[model samples]
Target: MIKGINKMLTKSKLEFLVGLGIIILPLQGLAAAAPTEMTKDDWLGKLKAVAPSVICQGFFEDASLKKRMEELKIDNDKCISLIPASFDKCQTQYYSGLPATMNKDSAAKWGHTIGECIGTDFATKYLVSNPQASTSSSSDQTTSSSTPSSTSPSTPSTSPSTPSTSPSTPSTSPSSPISSSTPATSSDSQSTDISRDQWLAQLKTLAPAMICQGFFGDPSLKKKLEDRSIDNTKCVNLIPASFEKCQNELYSNLPTTLNSDSANTWGHKIGECIGTDFAKKYLLPTATPATSTSSQ
Candidate 1:
């Protein structure tokens, strides 16, 4: 009886030890799987290093887009300096915090982890809205969206045929002086409209306003024009907020150099730029600055 009792106790002890080991092993594995978070300073430093690649990736050739990226970069640096970094609840936070507009391609480009995207978005917002946290929090904000749609509908037709009597024909008549002059006037108007459209299209693609004021001194615009002429164009109303900022800068800084007409022309050029193929590339949401492994 004594031997049986001792054997039972040993077996139970071995089972308990095995169970405890199983539980602890998984916990240790989890700890290893979890990633460490970075401090704001280290994260921002990494971002600063990677920023040129991020900003220049899509539309660097366009001066207006480059200027906007530069403006954002300034705010990015300031925000990273001021804001503390934290990403503990990455999975839970990312699911809840992701923007409605964020897509898979964007995530692949910007996300270290899904949660990092949320952290980035928050950082950008804080940086963009609050300047130094000491100055008033009245931030300059702008929003834009586009929806292009075209549809064609066909109408059903019904007709009835009836017998008719022969009718007398009218005598031949010469062209009237009014009709003769009308063709010339119409031709002149059409020519003027075509010329205006071509000019506006070229101006829009080139963004002459940003280019003209030392923003982008690409001689390529003139070269492109000489190589291939623009004939057809679509008008656009939306322009980047940076254009307004640039205009204000020009007016305030160089009052004698840039007039209202010049500003207006630049404004139109910006509008035209927004209508091009590159607009979609440039308009994509900017990804957040990357986080550092050692930041935590």
Candidate 2:
């Protein structure tokens, strides 16, 4: 009876071990299958591949725009060709401030923001009402070719008037603005005339106020800052200094005139730079020390 009980006990222990192994094998497989974290370079690589096609599709998918392009004889290929240049311009603005490493969720959000920037840049440059004139000119050419020779002289006269009117329209519009906003134009001209040193000094004085307002006023970002224990005072004190670094990096190719649109663009860029510096300095998770294990 003792021998039989020993055999049964040994068999039960073997079955328990086998069952535990079966459960653990899948868990191990699952752990191995888990995704590795992506670095900023990896995300940027993926963005370059994806952003152009996405932006082009958005423009081409618009029924009215597509129809207009068809009428204009503008090849969709032309739009595709412009994407590389647009993406290059926008990539630095959006991606330069991102952390080196990101988890899946954060990487996705960053990608979405960059995609929007690229789309805006591409649309601003390529999608214009001016291209419609090409279609009109082509129609004129076909009409002249089909008409009698006596009528051709009239077409030339009408074409000359069209070009003359085009130049006048732009001249009158600009003159009206210049006449109405004489003071504003003078101030703009004065700003253009300032030396670079004076401009930098002015920017430095303005940086603190702009940075503080942008940082604390943003609802989503404010929560993130609060979580990091970064309040208004700390932000004002610490972040304004980052503007100098950002200026050195981004302002080397500054436009001659810093108009309202350009100012807004640079403001966003500098703000991003400051935010990036702050994150690198403070927001990264601290590494925990590993516990020592004694060998048996």
Candidate 3:
């Protein structure tokens, strides 16, 4: 009986090996395929579902990455499995491939959460260091001083050199009080409410070209801006139609690998929120009129 059982087991094992060999023979010559290209809508979905903040945060300097590798005990072999790899691949694919499926509004809110973890100073530093970045907007200071008065009966001259110093600059001792009857400028239709000064101040900048009211999605962000008296009207007046236009330009300009929507979504994902929310949550209130430092 023992001899018969041994014979049966050996035969079964041999049959299984033969079956496996047959299955493997046809596929041996083919190379593995690359990951499928992610579309913008796909990225918007992921970003909405899973925020990329954890991966995108921190100093991306090569030395910093090496240090992080040591601290995290990351095996060199496993680095490809890490989200940081996605961050690195941004040049090849534009955005972290992980962010394509996010909801735009939620992406904005979660960005604030990440900003809370890192201070605002870090946020600006990260943004400023980006190779493809643009100028920081001193929107309020600029428009407050530079914008023409919607209150003025006079039309704004369009020449850039002539600087469209709007209805009033602060130093001017205008004879008339800013009147309610002052005609609405064409820009006024953009927002439903708020004074022109406050409105223009809301216009914030994004890297590579972006005009976004993305923060309006967050109640806390809204309250913070409100505390600072930032409203949509001022934002509209200062930015005008630049918001959507900037979004497209910035989106299109993302690294060649990423699709446009993915780039657009990611710009809102990593750039706008980090830059703006960091100021809103961590930096602004603590900012002193003198040295801008933090408190314990």
Candidate 4:
């Protein structure tokens, strides 16, 4: 009777193990065969659902990319939540490999690459129209200056353009009212809205091209400009008379570098050089009125 009971227990355990395997094996196969590609809606849906760690292998570790994502209103928690979907979508569309098979470091790199693609897409789709939304914190000083304060009502009535509490009012006196200043100049437009740091950053980003074109005299860039029917001299000139005009022409025609998609990749260094040249030749001269007057 004891032998019979022991045999019966062993048989039951074997049956249970076989049943468990039957249930799990198909689910494993289904997971392995899961689709990779996603539609536009699918991309967004994944971005909205995935965890941030999956988004960028611990997203906060990369400060610059993390800040960029946050600027897109993808906060840390939201970013984490969106990572799984975004990673899957990215793997389907942009990256074509088995992310599951990748090791820890490789997976992190893969995640970051996918994150950047998603970030670029986010910028193109949402940021173009709502530029202010992303940079609100950095631009707070400018926003505050533009905002109507408690004294603004009384101040605007007295001086429509100038803020009532401006320190420059002491120098203006009764003779030269700030509002009666020279006609709005293109130079003013160039300087306004953007801060010194902002302009300098922009200049640095564009300096490489400016140095190549204006200083080094890049022949290929010149030929490209000529081919476009653009006045090559305008782009290459740093002299005051033609400098601004040339820069304007180059800036407007920048998109033609190699079509809009490839332009940024090929044109970034050139653009940086142009920005540097503009700062040295144009921005510097106009920015220092006192020094120029003293020299004269």
* Candidate with best lDDT: 2
Backbone clash numbers for all candidates listed? 3, 0, 24, 24
Q: Candidate 3, residues 98-134: lDDT per residue as tens digits?
A: 2553333332222222222222222222222332221
Q: Runs in model 2 with CA error above 4 Å?
A: 1-36, 71-73, 132-296
Rank by lDDT (best first): 2, 4, 3, 1
Q: What's the residue-level lDDT of 289 in candidate 3?
A: 23
Clashes of 4: 24
Of models 3 and 4, which has the larger lDDT? 4
Q: Count backbone clashes in candidate 3.
A: 24
Q: Give me the displacement of residue 253 in model 3, in angstroms.
A: 9.4
lDDT of 2: 0.38
RMSD in Å for candidate 4, one decimal? 31.6
As a whole number from 0 to 100, the lDDT of residue 134 in candidate 1 is 20
Candidate 4: stretches off by over 4 Å: 1-89, 129-296
Q: After superposition, how far is residue 227 of candidate 4 from its true place, in Å?
A: 13
Model 3: residues >4 Å from true position, as ranges? Answer: 1-214, 236-253, 256-274, 277-283, 287-296
Overall lDDT per candidate, in order of appearance: 0.23, 0.38, 0.25, 0.29
Put down candidate 4 lDDT per residue, 30-99, tens digits, no spaces.
1121133333233222222222222232233333334545556756444333323323334456434533
TM-score ranking from best candidate downward: 2, 4, 3, 1
